[model samples]
Target chain A: MATVALKSVKKSYGDINIIQGVDLDIQDREFVVFVGPSGCGKSTLLRMIAGLEEITAGELKIDGKVVNDVPPDARGLAMVFQSYALYPHMTVANNMGFALRLAGVPKAERDAKVKDAARILQLEPLLQRKPGQLSGGQRQRVAIGRAIVRQPKVFLFDEPLSNLDAALRVQMRIEIARLHSSLAATMIYVTHDQIEAMTMADRIVVLRSGKIEQVGTPLELYHYPANVFVAGFIGSPKMNLVPVKVQSAGADGITIVLPGGGTAMIPVQSSNAAAGSAATLGVRPENVAISADGPIAGEITVVEHLGGETLVYVNVGEGPFITVKAGGDSAANVGARVRLSLKTDEANVFDTNGAAMVPKVRKPLADLEKRGH
Target chain B: MASKAQKKIGLAVLGWVVALLVFFPLIWMALAAFKTEIDAVSSPPKVIFDPTLENFNAVFERVNYGNAVFNSIVESVGATLICLIFAAPAAYAMAFFPGRKTKDLLMWMLSTKMMPAVGVLVPMYLIFRSTGMLDTRTGLVIVYTLMNLPIVVWMLYSFFREVPKEILEAARMDGARPRQQLLLLLLPLSLPGVMSTALLSIIICWNEAFWSINLTASNAAPLTQLIASFSSPEGLFWAKLSAASLLAIAPILVFGWVTQRQLVRGLTFGAVK
Candidate 1:
């Protein structure tokens, strides 16, 4: 419903900066997620956008109008906090209709709107129950229903599923995605869960230490991370980053000495990385294959047998453990010697500075411009 | 097992003994309220003496007891209401929108209560006299309100802090102004704490004797002054004094007993799971 733009937004407390200058453009109806670890300023940035926190510097615009001085209520936004924050003293219906009542909407109309929201959230039977009487998920639904009744221009969710159990988190995540599509309202969600970001976001803004690390679609980030941090943070079980010695660097590609006495030429532009310098070879668990004829050898340390996919943790020499994703029924036993084959095209090369060398052949789907930003 | 049972019985007996020890004076006073003057002052306190309501009748008839009771009720309740009106907002701001100096401010406010009231009695009395507030119910109410303000604000601040900050932030996002947040959200959430606070303030004001005796001679004198008046130069009227004291404390005793459950609950609000 509205486009939100932040131009060099910064937040600080005394000399400590919580959110460094952040520039981001969220298109109308875009489901943007601010994903980061704890103390990464994701929540603080979301609060700043919601007008709950003061932006120490820079301008924030909604619909192209700077609203740095606007109060939270005047910002036309509704938020669902992690605690649900349902009014414990009021019935579910009253909690949902609170904003409407505050806006001076007629009683009959407010009731109708609440009823409609209740039906949508499947809370019709719980309209009269207090928040204390409801289950955790039901309370979450009421929190969402409270936001829904306001019909605000933007909806902000601050780790709304962090408090729920795993199964309920997935269910609520799906419900939120459906709500976004149904309402088509611009939503800014802040969470440290990468799965939520990967599944629910139209574009994920990966932040680190108050700075924007990268901003792209889920697949774009997965296939082409901007740096080592994004590469390690975006994937499940983390990407295996092994320290490699660069043997040859050229316009064609860079050849790096892999661990356990193996060499692989990764097709990436490495103009900044010189030969004989230390660089990191980044490969996701799924991209590392366990094969008999593979060059890189290691001893299997751990085998995680998930139903659909198995994770094989291999101890390759004195370096860090490398994890390889294999079939669910993978019979690789612990203490057994195995070899890992690196998917060189899918692999990435980061110089000593941790900045990734651009891949020569970009995945068509990783194109952010084609994805409409 | 036998020793455990004996210990349990011993604990029960000890508890009863302690309870009786605490209640003995109240029981004796109640008994004296219904006795003759000679019986009240007799050696060993004449447990089997004939009971009479003559002391109560005489105490009620000799003075305007009804007017003093009315004045006590009005002054205590009026002071509590006025104190809450100021204390709630101050506590809300201190609890929710605290600054670097908020803790220091709250500590300073509580420090005022540590000073003995008599230390400033002369100054307060002179101020009241200059403002033409002597011997008036309004004057007593004002004094009681000021006397209880710091404690009231401290108690309310502690209660308000128990409310989670997230709820208030949600209210702001839901378009509630600061005033609406205080009235509609905070006051209801901390109702139990507020009730206990009002009860405590009213009890303090009702039992206060020095200020009532010093500030008012007749018109605004509360039950404390009424009880004090029983001490005359013609020797201590033990029977009439006991009767008057019993009458003056009966209402508050019953009120406290009725609200005992809520008082305990409020005091331990966040202590339990």
Candidate 2:
């Protein structure tokens, strides 16, 4: 029954404010991830919830009771640190049973609980070995096993897999997803890796410069970013934002002139944008296609063949270099001229201030409120 | 290639020569300890002679050797244990939760050691006299503990700093209180450092001569005073002085030899991987 709530939480160090007025609600059994670039206050927010950092000017509630002044152990929460923080001197079994021992649990019951957690983490064989003797992945499992023995209402992971190799990270990612389902505990994870946020989060909170840029489910952030920052930050190969001029605005949509003398009327609300003003058009790499009669044309500067998919970097006049995700068998070569067709239904329009003009029609999967649970 | 090999052999020979030169005085003293007064002060020192136990017997017969040995043991060991009890927690706080002024505070504590012992000797004597602490084992223990506190704190602080803060935080999250964390986690992890710190402290307190000579009389006089007693102004009895010196240093030398490995290991800790 862990439902964590924060109201106007703020953290400051004298004149320097690390977290500025953050409000969030994490529901029970939901895997929420706070993600941003470095120094974006994501880890600070997680620590505040763990009762590690003080909430300077806000109320934090866990299970409908204010726990702002509670000590970390009294909050009924467990944390897995980035370094895995295992006691190097203790055996795996003792490390897992330390909290139970402190709670005055009998030795027989403590051993049973430790064995159960070790079996769940597949660490039964390594129970008697010290942390230094275990490999990195095994030590990681021991750290998680320690957390699991406590059986806290909430689990907080601060970049738990950031230390693993690539293949191990993927394997551990799947293992964590499995653990989430098996335990059915509310979890809040913090990471700078956007791909982890996209894959593992039931809801992603994107933070930048101590403030939340946006919060939504994975596909919603992918298909309907709130502004230019979110649009550029949340996708692979990045969304291509090309400068354009506003030609006209009417009931149908707003018409903008592209770089290569092409006009496209994207269906977006332009209430604050006047005709003939400057604007930006955003298109995902997957949404841009190469065709003979396409409106915009550019010469391919570089082609990256990634086994199953190829990315084509093109230059159209003096505008920003745009990327196109094409088939693996793309016949396009460097220095070859290609025409690009923008998918208007999938296009996003932004005014001069970089604020995304609201879309008139909703993307079905992008509306998380309307989705069936 | 031949020159490099010759150079290596030459350096080894030179090292042995320097070591023997440094140990010559001790060797001479040990030899004299087994000689009569005439043989000890011979014009050319006696290299080979009929060695006798006369000097050792005379030195022991003249002084309360057993009481001095016991006093030395009790004062040195007691001072070291008490110093560690106070220094460990102070060092833990300074290492783990260092405020902006921590460096300054450490430097100040070390600066107290830089002042010569004689500079404060008169004042210390007056205080001891007024407080009825002069010529007592407790008085000597207090002085020795204070004398060794700075170095003990500094060494323990550096060792404690080597432990990662994450481990302590993890202990806190695991519901271990501060005292338990110190007892169960930190002390065991830094056992080697703590052991070497204790060894160094014991060695320093055992060998302390200035305070032992100035503050103590018959009842609390340690081996240092015993050794000094043999050097009377009536005449220099070289053989008996040598025997007393040998007696004073034998126990510490054996202790040092037995624990040399741990001493070297602790001193050079964190230098390599």
Candidate 3:
């Protein structure tokens, strides 16, 4: 297994810049996922690392050796494409054994390696079948098996589960997570699916327009997003961003007025923000609670029932719709008047420039200091 | 529902009318070939003449039908093979590894076919005569190969284009070299298309009347030229000529029958995704 470092990598097509300068370090044996919406350069970054695409600028190094000029084969990496790019003409055994065969391994060794990989992927019964005969999930297994047999230092998966049905995707996602632990190889997975990034990645690299918006553990990004984009992207049901203007500034905190008329004071430490300036207040849908007596009132516009939980979309006065995740058993009817309250400690404050301001809680640091050295 | 049955009947009647119109000449020719020379030229056209093998005997004797048939088979098949040999690689390069001017180059190649064959007949004949290729089987094969090359390349190029580039890329990532990609991936994927194009090329070469008739006297004369020879100095030799014409078309008819589905499928391959 090898650590991969991309230093100031950038990509462009003529005048259109696809990926601006991006620098990231994927430590050895860590499962790093690059997640973003389509056209956000997540796949481009993975392709660049796989050496499938040419690097327009900067250096990429694998295991501390500069490898910007290396071809894909020489990069010591194997990629499982979104399409599962299995050779249609080859049987499962040959597909998995291709790299070893190409490396000139003898027949006995090749068969053994393929058989072992087949066992690992539960593909023994599929060894003789061509890729066309396999279902999507099975083809994906063969694609993964193909990568596994290569035994490369790094495994790159480019949205490998996107083509499967929901159940199969979940099953395969877990299988891949298990594979990562079993192989202990450095793996980089790219997907637009946030839940996959949250559940599988050791470090989730959130990219937007070719720049790394944030790079941290999944919870770190979930609890402490670096910007409004990451905040809006990382969470399920999306973060409700309400426009606000600073009302008063003091050492203790800043009071900001919401778009419709209400004011809420939030403690945040940021040098750039000032009183009488524009900022956005972000609250995740799940963090917003509906109460009988609450600070804000709105008309319930829609409610999305998702079995265990319900997402209530509400229009407060004149502001944009704010969504709140409520109990599934609670019948929150549309067009009903409701009062909502923000979970302050879980809320995110952002400047007009879309930079997230970290919430300043008073007790955590002091408690840590008091408990230990 | 009532009109639907009438519509079906109307369509069936119309279909039979077209079929008979097409089959009438062939039926008359078959009848005439069985008649004596006197009956063959009868004014009212005898439909119930006594059938005989006299015309067949006359044909085999008067013209070397066997040599012509053999030459047609050899030249057509040889030309088809030669066309395929050159077309496959040219199509491969054009479809996948295209250079900057490749589109223009393809257009230029196609434009060569657009030019009437007779427009270059004089030059081609002079070159063939000078080179002593005027009446040789090898010369006919070479000419036919050239004649069919453009269509062959065009067909194969389109077929190659239908194959997903990802398949080739997957092969490359699997460590297949260029030659292996061609032999292992492209050739197998495009088998149906190549077979159809080969069949079509052979049919075209077999039916090529102008070049075969103009260039060959006896030595390399194909079935088309053989059919032309049955036209005597008189204005018409309908019965004998029709027999030779039917003989010339029979092989191609059989070939078309065997691969008809594949041919239609291949021709329409590019019209869809």
Score chain A of each prediction against the true chain A by TM-score and list the results. Answer: 0.97, 0.97, 0.94
lDDT of 1 at A206: 99
Relative to the unseen true structure, what is the C-alpha lDDT of residue B234 in candidate 1, on a scale of 0 to 100? 78
lDDT of 1 at B243: 96
Q: In DockQ, how does model 2 score against the reference complex?
A: 0.71
Error of 3 at B140 (Å): 2.5
TM-score of chain B of each: 0.93, 0.95, 0.91
Relative to the true structure, how large is the alpha-carbon lDDT of every model? 0.92, 0.90, 0.87
Query: lDDT, candidate 1, residue A65?
Result: 90
User: Best by lDDT, which number?
Assistant: 1
Interface RMSD of the predictions, in order shown?
A: 0.7, 0.9, 1.7
Q: Which scores greater on DockQ, model 2 or model 3?
A: 2
Write model 1 residue lDDT over A1-373, tens digit each, in one string. 5999999999999999999999999999999999998999999999999898999999999999999999998888899999998889999999999999988999999999999999999999999999999999999999999999999899999999999999999999999999999998999999999999999989999999999999989988988899999998997989999999999988889999988778889999988787899999999998899998776899999999998999999999957999999999899899999988989999999999898899999877844664564
Model 3 clashing residue pairs (backbone): none
Q: Rank the candidates by TM-score, best first.
A: 1, 2, 3
Tell me the spans in candidate 2 whose CA falls farther than 4 Å from its real position. Answer: A276-278, A366-373, B1-14, B270-273
Candidate achieving the largest DockQ = 1
| Ranking 1 against 3 by TM-score, winner | 1
